[model samples]
Target chain A: MFNDFINQFWPSTVDGLAFGSIYALIALGYTMVYGVLRLINFAHSEVFMIGTFGAMFVPFVLGINSALTGLALVGVIVLMILAGMLASAGTAVALERIAYRPLRRRGASRLAALISAIGASIFLQELFALIVIPNVFDRPQQGRIQMALPQIMERTDLFSIAGHPVKLHQVVVVVAAVGMMIVLDRLVNGTKIGRGIRATAQNPEAAVLMGVNIDSVVRMTFLIGGGMAGVAGALYLIAYENTNYYIGFLFGIKAFTAAVLGGIGNLRGALVGGVTLGLVENYGAIFFGSDWKHVISFTILVLVLMFRPTGILGESLQQARA
Target chain B: MALALGLAACGNGGSETTPADGGSNAAAPGTVKIGFMGDLTGANAGIVIPPRNGAKLAIDQYNKTNPAVKIELVEYDSQADPSKAVALAQQAIKTDKIVGLVGPAFSGESAQVGPVLEEAKLPSISASATNVKLAENGWKYWHRVLPNDGVQGPGIADFIAGGAAAKNVFVIDDKSEYGKPLADAVRAQLATKGVKVTNDSLDPAESDFSSVANKVAAAKPDAIFFGGYYAAGGNLLKQLRDKNVDAKFLSGDGSLDKGLIEGAGADNAEGALIGCPCYIATPDVTDAKVKGFADAYKAAYNADPAIYASEGFDAATVFIEAVKAGKTTPEDINQFISTVDIAGVSKQVKFAPNGEVEAKDIYIYQVKGGAITLLGKAAEAKLG
Candidate 1:
């Protein structure tokens, strides 16, 4: 058993970290929205989904088929990421304006807003499934089959760690996700708008009294969070090489769990939670078979909440610095 | 005694009233309604949609030839869900009042819908549902054009052990109702032949199979048999090849699809063997009927028939022949279908007492140059 554990450790860790990076990027969206509005933006996952479709559609419209290579591949990747971010940010702002903004103007209860968020999530998913994707994108079978993305880069081994060959795509995913997170972290900590967001999250009424435009700050938080999720979506296509309408549901739930596990309103906590969840799930699969991987991940969440409810970082929005 | 007689009279009156209403109904005397059910809008759409098209083509051909007796095909999409299949079966029997049915294309859906249609006395000939247990249910109304997995699995095992001369084999399944039982049957057959066999299962939703691929490479098997659909099978094959596991890959009919080559890439999919009961109308096939059917299919759908399209055409042909032979009532159709023997495009269609195809055979297909090439019939391909 010990030998088995030792042998599977490095490779599982590599797989876990690569997957975890994606989770972290998605979790940042949940964490930031919770920080400002004290509302769980359930539709954020759909925002990520729209980002992936945007990434695929932009290249397709530009006539970038499988033949792209070298510098052209790099240019396409950057363009895809930018397109994904723009689409996701646009969706997030629209959702805020349409769904959450009405509830806010009406001074509705938080529960009503949360339910509205859920409605938005389902509406977006079905819209893509039934109407928008099939008509606008001309993918009549979009919802039914897993659409294979154009393989932009050849899957070549970058290097081996402990006899395990790490592919170049995996490296790309991890680097891009981590780099985006670092940039987000700095922006949140070092900017004037960042201070406004921090103040609003700490005490919304107080921030309003202090002449901070609370609505703009909230919208900005959603835009930034949705942008991170969009980058994650682009990276996910490069990593998994497939996408469908329902892809967001599973990834969304997992990212939400990561947000909760990392201390819901804490930025750094979300990252730690994601990486930990991924590592735990991978190692658990090794010990208890791959079939029980999901069970183990969710069980870990229950165990964590049972012990330390605030999660690993154990700090809420008002308590933690940016 | 008076109450029982009164109840019987009411029941008799009710039975007489329905047929009287149905006789004068929108369906004229020469019109025969047949219901076709399958997953037209779900994960299995790629497999089921072709068959639906084939059924349509067969109906068109029948209508063109026989102008007097018109066959109207009432179609239902089950979405591959069991509850939905049951609802659709109920609708076909009660609402549509169909005398014959074409499919519940997947095994799981067929299993749920079979007994319901059987109780209604509606004869259904499935194009692709090949679970062996479906035939064993003793449901007299159910029939299949394709041979069950029981025959196909052993045929695959024999091809691997004898024709391919593989010493050791790894059997993997997706833990689905269709995949798991088929893998078990293959493993049992392989073990009976004194060949070494290893077993594993995978989640179909998972895209990454690197760990599983590495484990397979370490095992050093001579061949690998995956009993699953194309999506996971293609990913697994690609990962296995990437890990330098140069084992021969064999799979059941579920993986015999153009999507397999598309997913795994033509380079990775080359030389993989697929065992299927349905015949592939390769370009070189000289059977005039099959060649005609293939040409007509290409002209109609603008592509060659996928795995089960010909089987679907054959199934519909069987029902159309029965209708032409003066089998109108559900019971009459069921009785006629039970003993059907016709030379279909895919096979000589004949059902045994167990509702299985009497002509038990499997075709061995090899992926060459991104296309499925028929090697030979499995029994003939086998070596001593």
Candidate 2:
């Protein structure tokens, strides 16, 4: 009986870890932006959605008509990945400038940021829905853009331990996320700009007195956070290979949950919280049956919040300011 | 919030003139409205929109030649939420001037909306809702264009276990009334066939399913059958691959949406099967006019026209046939519809005494190369 239960536990743990990687990547954006601005960027999910749209649009832009030689196809796909990332990064910058920057400038409360995010989310979703795509085929096109590429976007053999198949997308999500986190860690902890960000996050009035360009730090934070979310979005579409107007809402909430679970303002907490939440939720489904999985994830989040109101790693707003 | 309510209230006020389902004056009312109720914004939009488009194309073409009776379509987005469907049905009956109703798209909505139409004595037909409990509820007004899941569940069981020789099957449901009951029906049928079934139920609201996949994959069942709509099912299929599970997947018509394959990622979902209630087998639908309808539908809608659209067209066609047969009063139309049998898209459309499709194909399709290729097309169970 115990052996059966143990067998179930291990597989669920692996499932959780794979999903956690994606959650962690997206959660980083939420945590970092919150850390700097003390405001939750609600349109972050729509940014993710736009990133997905970017990935879907990229392959079509490459003009790879059919299965080219494997090497050539790889080159095109690589170009697509770079183009998609750039597009997502560009979108993030625009969102920061257009939607968030003005609010920060006006010294709007966090509620204003929340409302702007909601408005931005609706705008992006409707934009995609109503946007007319130029048809190469004479047929009337659906709102979605289907790229002519290999249907299977992820390779399944890399992390296969013994005989188990490791999803190529999972590996990409984890590696890219870790690499981005490390770069972010360096930017925040080791650079002059990092000091400006910390100074702004610590005390806006004092930071201004200290001659810190708070605006640049805020813009830079959004740029970095948006870039990470863009990568996450591109990775999701590449892995899932479908784009829709509202798909981001589901993953967005999960990522937010991960952000809160980890101690919202802490970068490392976002990573730890994301991966931990993913594994816990996935394992919860496994042990209690699939139906109760979500109940379990939320229950754990509630429990964690009850015990440590600041989250497992998140500092309270006061502590962060201090 | 009040503005939103006011907007809805304004929309409701306009639909107040919607015709009662059964009124005394059925004599040559120059135009007939087919009321539509289904999700426009939420999850069921994928299923509802395509069929609505298909029905519109059929109505437009039909109206061009047959000037005596023109079909006007009135729509309400139920968001695949049942309570919303009831409110929409009430509006359709009271304000939209509809002679017959075309849809509520989903079974749960149909179940709730069905009784209201019965109370009104309105002859309404479901375009896609396939739950058996719907027809068995003793509602005189409710009818379905497609056969029920009671027939579909066993047919799927026969195909997967008996024909495909799948030894072990894992079944999961979204825990909604439609999803759970259908999953239960399939499990019972599989048990009858002496097949081993492992079953689980999950909340439909939860999008992630890595844990479920992990637990199910450990058993290594030959196929996974999810009796739920596309939203949760699509995520499940994706997460299963993410968790490295390679088992074949089979699901009911609830999962039969273009989004399912797109959302799940086409390559990973290869060899995944869907059990659909109605499909137009080209050879069987030999009429050039019907073929023309299919072409017109595919041209107007980017995706292939679903069987539900054909069924919606059939339901509309049934009303047309009934109108042509009699004095065009409610009693005459009702009697005419009960007796007539007409060959339309999907099958020869005939209703039982309880208002269900008498003969039809409930097919199993495999998603090979991102297209739904039909496997075994079985006739609807002739209930004893």
lDDT score, candidate 2 = 0.70
**How well is each residue in A1-322 modelled by candidate 2, as lDDT tens digits?**
3544676765555556766877887887788788878888787887777666666666665543333545664565456555556766777678888988888779898899889888988887667654623243211233432322334343556655544556655666667668877887788777888778777777878989999987788888777777777777666655555556666787788889999999988877888888888887766665567777667778999999999998897663224431
RMSD (Cα, Å) of model 1: 6.8
lDDT per residue as tens, model 1, B276-319: 98887766778899999988988877888888889999999998
Which residue pairs show backbone clashes in model 2?
A263-A314, A291-B202, B15-B95, B16-B95, B17-B95, B18-B94, B18-B95, B18-B96, B18-B97, B19-B97
Candidate 1 chain B lDDT trough over 10 residues, lowest sum = B15-24
Docking outcome class, model 1: acceptable
How many backbone clashes are present in model 2? 10
Pairs of residues at least 3 apart in sequence or in different chains that clash in candidate 1 = none
Q: List chain A TM-scores, every candidate, in order.
A: 0.96, 0.86
Off by over 4 Å in 1: A1-4, A135-137, A141-143, B1-25, B242-246, B382-384
